[model samples]
Target: MRTVDFSPLFRSAIGFDRIFDLAEAAQRVGEESYPPYNIERLDENRFQISVALAGFRPDEVDLTVEQNVLTLEGRKGDKEGRTFLHHGISTRSFKRQFTLADHVEVRGARSEDGLLVIDLQREIPEAKKPRRITIGGSSQGNLTQIESEAA
Candidate 1:
C-alpha cells in the first residue's frame, strides 16, 4: 500500500479539508466489496443507490444522513438453531458511508426484491441559485451636474 502526502494540498487549499480526508479514507478502504451496490444518476440533480442485501429485511437495515454524510447500516440476527449444509447467501452486518455534496439530500429509501434503494436529489436554495444581475444604468445622483460653473 502506498501512502500519499497531502501536506502541500492542506497548505494551499481552504475549506477543502473534508474532501481531502475523504480521499485518504477511500484509499484505506480498498477492495471492500461486500453487499455490492450501484450508484446511478437518475437525472441531472437526482441519483439512486441500489445495494444488494439478500436475506436481510428492511427492518434490519438503517439509513441516516448527517453533515453531508449518508450512512447505511445492516444488522442481522444470528442463526443459532438453524444448520445449513451449504450456505450461499450472506447475512452479515455491514456499514456503508457515502459523502454527499452540498445541497444534496436523501429523498427516500425502500427495499424490494432483496435490493435496498436510496434516492437522493440536489436542491439548491433560491438564494444560492445563480441569477442574472441586470446591470442597470448609473444612478441618478448627478442630476444637478455640479453647478460650479454657474456660480
Candidate 2:
C-alpha cells in the first residue's frame, strides 16, 4: 500500500485539514465493496446517494451524520432455523461512510423498492456568499480606526 506525506503542506495551508483527512480516508477505504451504492448530482448544489439494501427493512437500517461524515448501517437477523437451497441475495450487515463538503446538508432520506436514497443540498449562508466590493466606495469615512495607548 502506498501512503502520502502531507506534513509539508500543513505548514502553508489553513482550513484545509478536512481535505487532507478526506484524502487519507479515501486511501484507507479502498478495499471493501459490499452492499453497493451510487452517488448522483441532481443539480448545481443538489446531490443524492442510493444504497442497494435488498431484503432489509427500514427498521433494520440506520443513517446518521456527524462532523461532516454520513454513516449508513444495516443489521440483519440471523438465519438460524431457516434453510435455503440457493442463497443469492445478500441479507448480511453492512456499514458505509461518506464525507460531506462544507455547507452541504442532508435534506432527507427514504427507503423505497429496496433502495435507500439520501438527498443533499449545498446551501451557502448569506454572509458567506461572495459580493462585489466597489473599488472606491463612498462609505470610506464610516470605518472606525483603532486607538493605541503609548506605554
Candidate 3:
C-alpha cells in the first residue's frame, strides 16, 4: 500500500488541525463505494444529503448524530429461500459518515422513493452570531482630533 503525504497541506493551513485528523480517519476506513450519495445546499442555512438506497427499508437503516459527526448505517437481513440467477442488485451493508460544522444540526431524516434524505440546518445562537456595533460619530471625531494634534 502506498502512503499519502498530507503534511504539506496541513502545514499550509492556519487552523485546521481537526480536518487533518478526520482525513486520516477516512483514509483508514477505506471506501464504501456501494450506495452513492449527494449533498445539496437547500438554502442559506439549510442543507440536505440524499443517499441512493434502493433495497433498504426505513427501519433497516440507522441514522445517528454524535458530537459533530453524522453517521448513516444500512444493514439488510438474510435473504434465504429465494434464488436468483443473476444478482445485479446489491443489498450489502454500508456505513457512511459526514462531519458537520459546529453549529449545524440534523433536523430530520426520511426514506422515500428508494432515497434517504437527511435534512440539516445551522442554528447559530444569538450570542454566537456576528453582531455589528454602531460606530459613534463623536468617538471618531475625538480620535481624529487626537491623532491630528499628535501628528
The model with the greatest TM-score is 1
Task: List residue ranges in candidate 2 displaced over 4 A.
Answer: 5-8, 15-19, 137-151
Local accuracy of candidate 3 as per-residue lDDT tens digits, 65-105 = 99999999989989999899998889999988898988899
RMSD of 2: 8.5
Clashing pairs in 2: none
Per-prediction TM-score to the true structure, in the order listed: 0.81, 0.79, 0.75
Candidate 1 has which clashing residue pairs, if any?
Answer: none
Kindly list the per-residue Cα lDDT of model 1 for residues 1-151, writing each as its tens digit.
4889787999878988878897888787765678899999987889999999999988899999999999999999889999899998988899888989889999999888989999998887765664444444875432223322211
Error of 3 at 139 (Å): 13
Tens digits of per-residue lDDT, candidate 2, 1-151, equal 4989887898887889778877877888757777899999987889999999999989999999999889999999888999999999998888888989878999999988889999999987755665444445565633332333211
Report the lDDT of model 1 for residue 82. 100
Q: List the residue pairs that clash in candidate 3.
A: none
lDDT of 1 at 5: 72
